[model samples]
Target: MAEIAVLGAQGQLGRQFLAVLGRRARGLGRAELDLGDADAIERTLRRLRPQVVINAAAFNDVDGAELRRQQALAVNAEGPAELARLARTLGYRLVHFSTDYVFGGDRLRRPRRESDAPAPVNFYGYSKLLGEEAVLGAGAAALVVRVAHLYGGPSWSAGRANLVERFLARARAGQPLVITRGQTLNPTSVRDLVPAVLALLRRRSAGLYHLTGSGPCAAAEFAREACRHAGLCAKIQWISRDPRPARRARYTPLANQRWSQEGLPPMPHWRSSLAEYLLSAQNLPIRD
Candidate 1:
């Protein structure tokens, strides 16, 4: 049994991590543990004393981050830095999650690698990249994982609706679902991500890795696929321009070269995982 402690335990990814850990782990939700509060985190860590601490908490509002840069930096950058410091001092392995927005490749087709130089275009991405640097710079045995567009399963209590659910809702209502066509990303399912994360943890791997679905797809394509998988009539409208304040990358498909190099099997493609998620009992809409 692995002694693991999951921060952001109620999040989509965090919930999946706990399910994988089962009785061997303890979870710390927002009320239980605030990443912004370094003293609180230290006290909780001292109490749990888990061998591995997974920091899944983040200020994930991409557009909102443009409005609240300080808050985003506090949670996304400073908090992780403190956690890394604690992990180093307390002798625990730290596993942190990052985003694909760290790269400035809007026109590039190839997926970004762990060794690629990070040049974030938005405040949110910059903050996440900073967090990753903080963890590694702290000199802790840390694994910094950068994942692509993520959607989760039935058991997720992420405190907000997922992309699939939001799309399904708009589709079922016969509403015109507008998705960005200009941006291309690999949509990774939490179903597949949990196992990949577990494999990395089992190896107790350190440094950076990219974990995402295999294919690069546009958001509109993803919406159409989700609607098709759910057997819903969708009126998906494609939009090349996003009016949002945050500057999103046009192409950010991540390649799991490091994961493969580490001898782990490749993850399923986005379509394959989307079909499985759409067919889940919780994801299905009630029939008239």
Candidate 2:
């Protein structure tokens, strides 16, 4: 069996990766280890000495990160740089997760390929882009998989704000969900993502890749689909604004042909995967 180490085991992506790769790797969360201190992270990796290392930890609060840019950079950029350097020195393969936010400023019509020039808009995107830069600069064996709008877990995880939580928040209160119809991207599911990441571990393909849902849709359509899955029959009122508060990428749905050419499957369309998430969540207690 291949020995692997997973950081951020408590996160949506990390937890999903662990559930999908159970009994096949070693995992750690902030409780067991922290990524803030680069030296500590390196020490943990050195001690484990795993063949594959997955770094899922990140400063993910997009709005909050605007105020705490340095902290975001520390975890997303500086910390990963240290891990990449150490991984290169130790002769181990590394895998890092980034976000679609990396290309928000560019309002392009075509699907953003892995080769597109990165021009991040917000502090969060800037930080993640820096992390990608660090990973490449290390010159180690690593793959940076960029994903968007992931929503799923082993259970009905109802905290820290996911797309599911946002949907549920509106549904339970019988309120109108005013979602943007202009924005578009691959709204990925964590279930689809974890499996692909595990597949990469088996092969360790080193390159930048898009690992997202099959198709792109507006947030309005996505919200309606989510409500349908939640056993709710609520009608949402679509609203248009002059300029949205968030610096959203007009249309950055990713193309995953690269991963497909290597025989790895792309994430299923958001609707299919989301239906599975809601049905599975029926048993878990619905938060009021």
Candidate 3:
């Protein structure tokens, strides 16, 4: 068995983790491991007996979760809970990823700390919050990382692209982009996040932690920055409200306070990381 096992291997963050870990890790995609199947998860982990199990799989359709609550709960909440239990029984460390949507309806506009009380405004956030509680509540060595607006790596399964990629794609195609204005978050890159996660694993850090890019910005601002960095000019149509049915948190910038106190390396600012990502994304038709 490999030292590390990464679930959701086809995902943006999962792919990055596998690339970084190389031969030390074994990747399990949806066909090999289904998050909704508890018994299958147990059987797979028991057989693999990996020293570490990283659950990067999640039902991330924020708006779709409102319609498919059961699917969301099963994948996001119940799945992690089972993994946490197995980690204790199987003697493997578990690392679970969560989201910033776990914080909403907060009057405070600052970046949320690990100690902040979560008040998820949507079903997706609520489900992830339940997952975090379960993993941390289970008496196992687990690290629950809350990230926001992830934006590096290749397109995810089903051709779903990250925010930065979406913006760059549209800008390159000479299409006008319509983005929301009020919603804010720290646009984290999977490139930076994968290393930080490895560092946390090295430290054997347990419980909850917030890991994201340094700077926070609105969706429109993030899009504009992506275009600028890619050296593309495109018209942006900014709207004040989200047209989607699911409600989003207005200000949910996660602060890496605990990671900082642990003496981990600081994440780069969103702009710098965005610039680096655009430069590295050679497949995209990035203009000079």
Q: lDDT per model, in order?
A: 0.85, 0.79, 0.89
Q: Give the deviation of candidate 3 from the true structure as CA RMSD.
A: 1.6
Pick by TM-score: which candidate is best? 3
Sliding window of 10 residues with minimal summed lDDT for model 3: 279-288
lDDT (10s digit) by residue, model 1, range 109-212: 78888877889999999999999999989999899999977797543354587878888878878898877777678898988988888788888888899999
User: Tens digit of lDDT per residue, candidate 2, span 82-177?
Assistant: 888988899888999998889865447877788888888888989999999999888899888998887776434625667766777778788887
* Number of colliding residue pairs in each model: 0, 0, 0
Better of 2 and 3 by TM-score: 3
Question: How does residue 74 of candidate 3 score in lDDT?
Answer: 97
Report the number of the highest-lDDT candidate.
3
Off by over 4 Å in 1: 154-158
Model 1 lDDT at residue 187: 91
lDDT of 2 at 7: 88
Quote each prediction's TM-score: 0.94, 0.91, 0.95
Clashing pairs in 3: none
Q: How do the residues 1-288 of candidate 3 rate in per-residue lDDT, one tens digit apiece?
A: 699999999888888899899999999999999999999999999999999999999999999999999999999999999999999999999999999999897489889999988999999999999999999999999999999999788764548888877788788888888876676889999989999988889989999999999978887788887887767886888777778989986788999999999887789999888878877746455474
* Candidates' RMSD to native: 1.8, 2.5, 1.6
